[model samples]
Target chain A: MSTALLHTGTHENQTSLAKKKLLPYWLLAPGIIWLTIFFLVPIYQLISTSTQTQGYGIGTYVQTYRFANFMDAITSSKAQLFRSFEYAFLATCFALIISYPLAYAVAFKSGRWKNTLLVLIVAPFFCSFLLRTVAWEQILGEQGFVIKTLRFLHIMGAQGHLTATPFAVVAGLTYNFLPFMTLPLYASLERIDIRMMEASGDLYANALTTFRRVTVPLSMPGVVAGTLLTFIPAAGDYINAELLGNPGTKMIGNVIEARYLAIVDYPGAAALSLILMVTILILVMAYVKRAGTDELV
Target chain B: MVDASSSAHGDLILKNLTKTFGEFVAVDDLDLVIPEGSFFALLGPSGCGKTTTLRMVAGLEEPTSGTIFIGKSEITYEKPYKRPVNTVFQNYALFPHLSIYENIAFGLRRRGVKDVDDQVQKALDLVELTHLASRKPNQLSGGQQQRIALARAIVNRPALLLLDEPLGALDLKLRRAMQIELKWIQTEVGITFVHVTHDQEEAMTMADTIAVMNEGKIEQMGSPADLYDNPQTSFVANFLGQSNLIKGSIVDSSGESAVVDVFGTKIGLPVLRNHAHDSSVLVGIRPEKIRIAPAGTQMNGNILEGGVISDASYIGVSTQYQVEMPWGQELMVFEQNDDGTPPLSKGDSVVLSWSPIFTFGLAGDQDVNAGSEAHPESE
Candidate 1:
């Protein structure tokens, strides 16, 4: 009778414990389902398509495993891949340099003007990305105000245009991704204890030394996050190149778009998309290993 | 290491330093001379400008006027980093990313000190944190973090070490332990420590000299015993410990003593040389100094008759009684709980008396002992 009572008690306790464990999962069910359907499934399909081919079983995988396509993507089409990387890297660097001071001003220096400055930084996003890019095209075209000013200054000829250049593509990318860099950096810098800097200064460290030793190290997580945000999108972005850039500045995204739409090569597009996602995932994982995400948050 | 040059002559001197934040004056003109190798405490209640005074001395806060000297060098307008002082913040503010070793070594690195390993190790050993040198700040307890902060500051061997409520964050037991440790460290390092705190007991126990501040001014600056036994101001008397302020008028002043009349009670208080005549006075007597007797008993010294309207509450080693006199004045007397025996209970009439020498007469009209405002009788 005691054994039976113990068994029944254990069963009841297990049931209650199970309910406690299941409650959180029940609450999280909708989000998990949405992520699975939208993101995970699409990624899985891309991977599967990359590995399959029409001729031999796993032929595409074998060919891709040789990395000839990657080399071809890099070398062929008039140095398209290399030029794309150069433009994206430059854009990401420029964005970082410009955004840091802006973030610092918004986060620490602006004081009562912080909210207003942040609103201004985010106001560019009020218009859609496509619309903004098109607007940039209009402003940088041959008849645009910038070209007209440059010609008037005698810095450029009358026919000088900012459109269809790598510069225009990078400028567009920087404008589009600036908020991504600034917001995270601002968040990170804002949470830094101001007293720490004061303490450092009191310890005889000059302003420059304090910044290098205390401020920069403390804001590493934000730097990593901003870099990831800007780099990933800039690497894959083809819209800027398509709208304002010439054929030479077309990125991986353009190649993928052409393969899927213009060439009707779904397999090649899927393969390229898979490679890009994997590369980004690897880089992000490496970053997370170096700078823990908890610090950023 | 104690800088022999500074040790020969006291490092810090604040001459009439004042700091005003807009309309609110945080620190009124304050003058203090902190000797080298002394643990000085800026003790006061919150918003009394104790922290502000310390910060000004450290050059963290610029004084509105007056001058500051460190080792005979004027550093009134110098920036904080340029001043020969370092501060251990209340929260420790240990660099979270750095290990204990790195945190201690940070200042050294900034100063470009060579062979920092020895200095870092010595600092860790001084704080008894050698074994935990590799651990991050978050992995350490509050006390450990506090020690790390101390280690970080002393690693630089600064001329003056400013501690801004360093022990305020610790638990009572830990705080007590740290107080001793801090004193020991200060003595061992022989560095002048200017500690800011609102805790009276902490000031009494740790500080060699206590400067009691009130409303941006130093009301009284003296040794702990001097301030406690002979509080010059009412603010000091009430702030340092509980004191019964008996409102009285100076009936007569003779030589260095005065006879003050409190209602119908006449008490003689030793007056200072500067005591004013015909002015209202406050007779400040500590609770412990006041003795209680059963009603109708003839007391040996100056006595006031009252009834024990409230029973004594046994507080570990002492029993506190609330006695109400016939004139409607309430006096609190504390009796030692000897041999765990109980004392008189409620509704018992008692007489309260103290020796004439124990009573301190403060010039009440000066608003020194009155704290915020003048008593109506004195007004």
Candidate 2:
């Protein structure tokens, strides 16, 4: 009788746990289905359209396997490829440097002002990205306050112009991706126990030592997530380079857009898009391996 | 590994220490001198400033005013690391990212100590965690994690070690085991161990001296036996252990004895108070000191006639009885169950008696109310 009772109790506990596990999936099913339809299906269609042959066997693959196209794009447009990566890398580094302290202040120092600071950080999202980027162009234009200030400070020479420079493009990218970096870093830093720092200090580590040993290691998940979010999007961004950069500052995104829309080269555009996607996939996989993906989320 | 500069019998002296969080004073004008090489416990209920005092000493908190000294050195402005102190947090606060070996080596590494591997191995051996040195805190049991926390703190060999309810998270059996283990570890290390706990039994069993705190003040401070036997205040009497506080007026008083009428029964107490003619006082007696006999039995010394109102609970080696006296006073009596079981039953008439020397008198005031109010809430 005791054994039977124990079995029933165990069965009841297992049923409860199973039901709890099912509830989350039940709630998540609709979102997964929506993504599958809108995002996954379209991506699958893009891959199939890039590889499928029309009327002949493997004709599209054969035509596009002009793997030489990838080489040609890189060799002929090496400037644009390097410029895009350089601008994206610089922009990501700038965003990380500025956002880490901002997120730290919001997560640890602001205390009761945390919610208000977070709201302020996210307030830029209320404006359209194009409008915000356009606003920066006006601010850095010849007649703008920055140019006037620099001229007043005797820093701008006769040839000094903020518009149409790689600096402008990188700045624009950093501005566009600042929120992405700040929000994830803010989340991770906020979840860190304040006592951990106190414990470090109590163990004879100064502030800098504690930050290097404890704070940076613990916040790596956020750093990886923020880097991926900013770098991937910035690499493919065309608006900032188009609006704020010179003709010499054209990025890979501009080339892909020109191939698809201006030049009407659908195969080339798809191939370039696939390459960008693969690069991002490789980066994400590496990040997931280093810092557990669960921690990232 | 202890800091040799402050190692001459590292005694801690706090002078007029006070801390306030906004309008609430957590610790008020606290002055305590803890000698070196002694296990001292700060005993109090939650929010009584015992934890705040411990934190101030650990340098986790800054006092609103006053100074602290460790072995003739004024360390009031010193950071926790600069001071010769380490803390074992209540939750054991072991670094989750590091293994036990790395956790123990953290302080030594920060201090740039040589031979870290040998020191880590020694600490692991001291805590009996040599086999589990590679294990993470999450992978270990609660008791094992507690030992690792102790190992982490003592490996640094600071002049003082502070523990804030270190065994509070363990199960009863584990807590009991760790209590003895911690006491033995403190003896083996021979360091100044300032432990904070709300468990009176834990304090009594482990501490060389116990300071009972209440409402941001040290209500009483002495050895566990001193606090238990001759509690100066009613708060000390009730806070340290279970006591029946009988309210009465002193009708007769002499040098070291007083006759008090409690609920129309004249009970002779062995404690004398100045100006006790018409002064109201409280008589405190531990339940174990009171003996229970079957009715119609002759007894000696402050005998009370009562009937057993509750069933006798056989708590391992002792039986506790709740006897209801004629004056509606419910008295608890603990009888040793040496032979086997209790000889009394529920609703059986019984005689409850205690010796005069077993009872002590405390001044009747708000302190008595404070003791009574704080005692039941802790349990």
Candidate 3:
């Protein structure tokens, strides 16, 4: 009887322990289901479409398993893909340069005005994203105040127009994604204890040395987050190119959009989209590994 | 290796140094002279301007007026990096990204030291953290990080080393261990150390000279023993340890001693030691200085009769008694638990007595309860 009771007790303990171990997985089920339905399924469908051959009807494609479509799509539009990365890289660098000082000011120097400054950093996000991009076109127009001032200062020639140039496109991309760069940098910089700076000074490091050695390294996590946030969306963005850029500066995103919506080439668009997605994943993984912030991942 | 030139560094002097934040005075016209190669402490409660003073000396906060001289050089307006002073901040403030080795070498590298391997290794050895040299600060415990902060500053062989509550974050047991370790390091290096802390025991244990500050002013400055045994202010008497101050009026005064009356009892006070400016004074005696005896015992000076032990706590080393006097004032007395005598219990009849030498007289014109602010029990 005692042996039977012990057996039953052991069985109950094992079941309860199993429940405790599975509790976390049960909690994670909702997120996993959401990702599978919303993200994974669409990606799978896109991948399958990327391998499909062209069909006879407009906007209709058959799954013939033609993997050569990816190679053909990449070879045909390699310039646009390269240009897209170039613009995104330039925009990310420019955003970093501009946002770091702004973030630093908001984090350390604003003092009593910190809340006001942070709100202003995020103020652009409250407006419609497309509306803000359209506003940039007008701002960079030849007749606008900004161009007029540049003309007066001889920075731009009388015949020069910024409306449909690569400069205007990159400028618009930079302006549109600035908040993404700034907020993460601000969060990371703000988390740093001010005593660390004082300790640096106390340890006989000058202002510049301290900033380079202590402040910059400590804020790298934020820099990484901000750069990724800005670059990913900016690389995949075609709206700025459509509105502010000419045919010579067209990016891969614009090509993909044209193939899918304007020309009704589903297989070609899906192939380009898949290529862009894989290339970005590889680059992001490499960058994250080089940055040595697996904890952030 | 010791640098002979660094050892020859002179004293740190502050003359009429004041720091004001708009309408509020953080550090009032403070003047202090810290002798060379001495361990000095600025002890006070929070918001007492001890930190403000240390910051002014470190060149972190610019002083509103006056001059600061390290040795003979007037570093009043000098930049922090240019000054040959270093600090161990309250939170250790070790670089989160840098390894223990790099953190120790940071100051030396910044000052253009090309070869720092030996110095960094020496510092790691000094802190007994050589094995953890490759680990970042976050990987170390609080005590280890604190020692790293110290090693980082001292590796530069700065003329003056400032410590702003360096052990404030450690647990009690770890803090006690670090205190001895820090004191040993300071002596081994023989650098002038200025430590700021609100902990009395931490200060008393580490510093050769202690300055008790309150409200942006120094109440008393002396050796720990001098400050404790001969506190001139009521604030010092109660703040340092615990004091039983009794109100009294001086009846007769001689060269060195004065006769005073408390309730119905008479006591002799050392006039030379007292800084009283009025006829009325408060006689101060430490709790441990007062002896507890059975009621009706023949006692000499400063004896209170007809007192009952209102409360008694046997705290291992000593038995504390709160004796309620005839005049309704409670006087605390500590009797050492020696000779295995049976401890005193509450409500027992007792007499409180002490020698005249232990009695300090403060100006009675001041508040009798000036330093009687409720202090949190020390850990």
Candidate 4:
């Protein structure tokens, strides 16, 4: 009789346990189904398309498993690939250099004006992205004051112009994504207790030493997050290169865009797109790991 | 365990130190002298200027009009890093990114010390945290991090170490253990330490001299026993410990003794010991100093009769009673539970008695509860 009672208790517990275990999966069903349909299925299609070969007609392809398409795309457009990384790296560095002090001021010194200053930092976003890029075009144009000042200072050659140059492209990238860099840095710096800085001074460190030893290291998480936010999108950007840069400064993004649309090369575009996506994923994984900010990943 | 007369090289003297934020005064015309190698405590409820005074000494805050001297060098205008003082912040402010070893070595490295490892290792050993030398500060428990903060400040060997509620973040058990450990460390190092805390027990346990502050001024400054036995202000009486203050007026004054009348009874006060401002005075007595007995018992010295027990609480080592006197004032009395008498219940008529020598006098013109009012924690 005791064995029978124990068996009944176990049977009841098993039913409840099964129901409890199914609750989380049932809650997760909507998100999982959405991602599978909208994200994973497209990625699968892209992978399959990347291995296809060009067909006899325009806008057509065959499932030939032409893995060599990726190699061909890389060899042909290696300069653009390298330039994309170079421009992105330089822009990220400039954004960081410019944002650190601004973020610090907003975080620590703005006092009653902190909110107003933050709004000012984000005010440019009210305009469309393309409109902002076009605005930069006018500012850096040959007829604009910036170009005139460069000429007056003899910083540029007699016939030199600011627009349609590598400098303009990088500048536009820096300006467009600056808030992305500033906000995270402001968040991290704001979280630093002022007591820590005072304690640093109490420990015989001068102001500069305190900044180097304490302020910079404590804000590394913000630095990692800001750099990723700026660099990842900047690397794949094509608009700046198209409008502000000359042909010599073209990036892999411009090539992939032209291959897909202007050149009508679907297989080549798919392979190039796949290579870009995979390379970014690998680089991001390695960077986050190296930064020791695993929580960001 | 701290002595005020020894180690004459590291004394701190402050004169007319004042700090004001806009129209509000934070530290008002404060004057102090901390003897060399003495563990002095600036004890007070919050907003009493103890921390402001400490900050002025550390050069973190500039005094409006004052002179600060460390063994005779006027350092009022010196920058914080230039001052020969360090502070252990209230939150333990350990650098989150640095290991325990590096955090301790920071000062040495900044000053370009040649042998950092030895100094850092010695400090680690001083705090008994050599085992955690390789761990980052965030990886350690609050108690261990507190020790690291101490080690970090002490490793610099500054002339004065200002600790701003360093144990305020720890659990009760850890705080008690650290109090003894801090006292031991002060003795071991023999460095002049100026500690600021709101905890009366912590100050009494660790300080050689405590300056009880109220309203940005020193209410009383003396050794622990002296302050407890003879508090000059009602603020000091209530802030340091619980006091049963009886409202009274001086009936007679003489060379060595004065008589104060409370209700219908005349209680004698020690003239030299009392600090009464006028005929109006508040007679004060600590709870433990008063003895309670059955209503008809004979009493000598100072006595209060016809008090009914209002409340009784059994607290293991002692029984605390709230007695309602005939004058409609409730007085607290603590009786030792040594004789194993039956516990007194509420409504039992009792007589309270204590020696006249234990009574103190404070100016009654002031609010009896002025400095003793309970305030939420202020920074």
Candidate 5:
């Protein structure tokens, strides 16, 4: 009887231990289920549709497994794809150049006003992104103070227009994504021991060299994060090209939008979307490899 | 330009150095000359302006109204980068991104010096961390990182190496080891090291000359033995080590010894050790200097009578006795265990005696408890 009781007790202990072991999986269930329904399911549907061919009737698609649609989409919208990357790359570089100094000033030099300055860096998020872009449009418009002042100072010719140009599109992207760059830069720069900069100075590095060798290199994690955050969204963006850019400044996102809404080409749109996603993945991986975040931690 | 060969190697002199942060003065009209190649220490409690003085010397902080010279060249207005001074910061501020090799090579490379490999390798070997050259700073332990920080600065071969509490983060055993190593390194490199630390033992272990700072002024500056044996101020007497101060007044001054009256008990103090501004003085004695014996037993030196052992604690190496004298002042006595005398217990009547040369007198008006506790910086 004692042997049987011991066996039963061991069995119960094993079952309870099993429950404890499964707790983490049960906790992860909600996230896994949500992703399966919302993200994974959509991806599967997108992949299946990208290979489909048009049916005999309008608004219909047949799964013909025609991989040629990807090539067709790429050939037609290749310019837009390259333009998107170029604009995004330029916008990311501009945002980084503008944000790093702003972040450094706020982090080290602000002292008592640090919190106020940080709030200012992030305060623009309270206004709608579209509204801020529209404000920029007015500021750079022909009759706006910026253009008039530049024309008066002879910095710009009388025929020079700020709106509907590649410059305007890149500027809009940079302005919209600035906070994304600045916040991370501020976090990393603020976390730097101020003494490190002092040590650099003591070690015979001038102010500019210290910034380049010590300050810039030490803030690499923030730089990488900021660049990715700005570049990713900017690459797939269509709003700036639509509102502030000329027809020549059209990006791949605009082409995808046109393919789906204006032309009713679902397969082609799906193929283009998959191509854009893959291209960004490859570029990001290559960039991360070359940027070398091995020492970031 | 700081010609490292000539201008950097001479005495570093600070003339009328004063730094004020608005309403409060951090370092007030301080003048000091740290002799060339000496391992000098600015020893003080936290915020006693020791670090501020060091920073002024390093060109990190601009003095309010002072001129600094590395032998005749005025460096007060010079930028930090232009000065031939490098600092091993308190926190070992190694560049987190750089490997140990690159960190040591930084100063050498910044000066546009070619072939930094030999110097970097020598520095890594000097710190005895040649194996850790390829690893990043975070991977190293606190002690290792500290050595790297030292290596990073010394690779530049700066004339002055300022160590700002470089061992403050280490455990006691490691801190002790680092103290000896730092002293050895200073001697080997022959740099005029201006070390700043609140730790008295660390300062005493390494510094050839120590400047004990208190509240924006030097309380006393002397060799370690001189400061410990002949402190001129109550702050120095209590801060350097433990001191048993008894209120006394000078009764007679005639030969080599001056007689002091402490609550009707006559005590002998050396005439030269008297630093009191007036006849009123606080007689100070170190705890270990005093010997304790049962009452009525014979004792030599300046003797105190009619005292009872109120407290006796037997630590491994020594016995500590707190004797309540007839005057109601409890005098501390530390007896080494090497003496074969039977251990005295609490409540036993005892006599405290020490050589009169150990008795130093300070100004009576100074606070007796000034340096017992850690004073808040700047307050």
Candidate 6:
């Protein structure tokens, strides 16, 4: 009778345990179904399309497992691939250099104007991104006030122009993704204890030393986050290159876009996309490992 | 490592040191001289300007009007990094990104001192945290972090070490332990430590001399026992510990002592202890000095008769009693639990008596509860 009683209690606990265990999966059902249909299915289809060879004339392909398609795409568009990374890296660096002081001022010295300054940083976003890029064109373009002023000051010669250059493309990328670089830095910097800075001063560190040793190191998380945010999207972006650059400055994103939409080269486009995704994964892993979150608590 | 400078060190002095934020005076023309190698405490309530004085000394805040000197050099406008001073900030602001070892070595490294491993290791050993040298500050407990902060400041070995409520975050038991540890460390290092705190007990426990402050001014500065036994101001009397202040007026003035009358009873006050300029005075006595007894019991020295017990709390060490006298004032009395007498119930008639030597006189015009509530953490 005692054993039977114990067995019944175990049975009751097992039923409740089963329900409790299944609750998390039930809660996750919507996201899982969404990812499976919208994300995973496309990934599988992209993989399938990447290895196919042309079976007939236009828009027709067969499963030939043509792995060399990736090599062919890379060989043909390697310049664009390298250019994409170079532009993204430069933009990320410039964004970080510009945003650190901006974030610092907002975090520490702005006093009552902190919120206002943050709002101003995000104010450019109220307009559409495309409209903003076009506005940059008008501001930094060949006939813009900036170029005219530079020409008047003799900083630029009579033949100098701002549009259709690598500088303009990188500048556009930096301007467009600036907010992405700023907000995370602001959040991380604002959480730092002011007492820690004063403690650094008390420990015989001058202001510059304190900033380098304490402030910068403490804000590394934000730096990492902001760099990733700026770089990833900037690398895959084609709008800025198409709007601001000449054909020579085209990136891998532009190539992929032309291959898919204008040329209808499905296999080549899919192969290039996969290569870009895999390379970014490898680079990001190495970057995070080198950045070393081990120092953070 | 902190070098104890030899000839240039005399005292940390402030001449008319003042700090004002707009119209509100934080430190009002404060003048002070902290002798070298002494553990001094600036004890007061939160807004009483003790911290403002400490911050000025550390060069964190610019004084509105004043001159500060270490020996002969004026450092009123000196940069914090340039001054030979270090402060253990409140809440143990340990650098979260740095390991325990690095945090302690930060000062030496800033001064371009290479080979800092020995000093850092010594500091780690001093705080008994050498085993956790490689761990980041955020990985430590509050008490451990507090010790690391102390080690960091002490490792710099400045001429003056300012501790701003360094143990405020610790639990009571740990606070007691750290209090003793800090006092020992001060003696061992022989650095002039200026501690700022609102905790009266902590100040009395650790300080060689304590300056009791109120309203941006020093009410009294003396040894702990001197302030307790002969408090010149009502604020000092009440802030330092529990005091029973009985309203009285001088009935006779003599060479050695003065007699003050309380309602109907006469009490003797030592002439040296009298602080009143006129006949009016407030007679102060610590609670534990007065012994409670049943009415009509024969007692000696400054007896107040016709008293009834109003309340009694039988704590483990002592039984605290609230005694109501004939004059309609409640006087507190603390009786040791070892008295071998049964606890007195409320409304029991009793008379309070104590030696006249324990009595002190303060100016009667001052508010009796001036520092009672200002004790901040007084129970």
Write down the TM-score of every candidate. 0.91, 0.90, 0.94, 0.94, 0.94, 0.96
The regions of model 6 sitting more than 4 angstroms off are A1-19, B1-8
- What lDDT would each prediction earn against the true structure? 0.81, 0.83, 0.88, 0.88, 0.90, 0.91
Task: List model 3 lDDT by residue over A1-297, tens digit each.
Answer: 999999999999999999999999999999999999999999999988988876776777899999999889989999999999999999999999999999999998998999998889889989998899889888888778989998999998999889899999999999999999999999999999888888887776778888998899889999999999999999999999999999999999999999998988888999999889989999999999999864421
For residues B1-379, could you state the per-residue lDDT of candidate 6 as single tens digits?
3233332366999999989999889988888999989999999988999999999988899999989998887889988888888899999888888888999998989876766999899888888999999998878999999999999989877889999999998999999999999999999999999999999899999999999999889999999999999999999999998899988999898758899999978889998999988999999999999988888899999899998998999998999999988888899998998967898889999988999999999999999989999776653
What candidate 4 gets wrong by more than 4 Å, as runs, is: A1-20, A151-158, A294-297, B1-9, B375-379
Give the Å error, residue A218, model 4.
1.0
Quote the positional error of residue A137 for candidate 6 in Å.
2.2
How many angstroms is residue A22 displaced in model 6 relative to the true structure, after the best TM-score fit? 3.1
Give the range of the ten consecutive residues with the poorest summed lDDT in model 4 chain B.
B1-10
lDDT of 5 at A142: 87
Most lDDT-accurate candidate: 6
Better by lDDT, candidate 6 or 3: 6
Q: Candidate 2, DockQ to 2 decimals?
A: 0.39
Model 1 residue B232 lDDT?
75
Give the Cα error of residue A53 in candidate 3, in Å: 1.1
Cα deviation of A61 in candidate 1 (Å)? 15
Interface RMSD of each: 3.2, 3.2, 3.9, 5.5, 1.4, 2.1
**lDDT by residue for model 4 over B226-317, one digit each (tens)?**
99999998888888888888899999987577899999898888897678889999999999999899899998889989999999999999
List model 5 lDDT by residue over B85-175, tens digit each. Answer: 8899988889888899999998888877777999899999999999999999999999999999999988888878899988999999999
Fnat, one value per model: 0.64, 0.40, 0.81, 0.77, 0.94, 0.91
Clash totals for all models, in order? 1, 0, 0, 0, 0, 1
lDDT of 4 at A242: 94
Model 2 residue A85 CA deviation in Å: 1.8
- For candidate 6, the share of real interface contacts preserved is 0.91
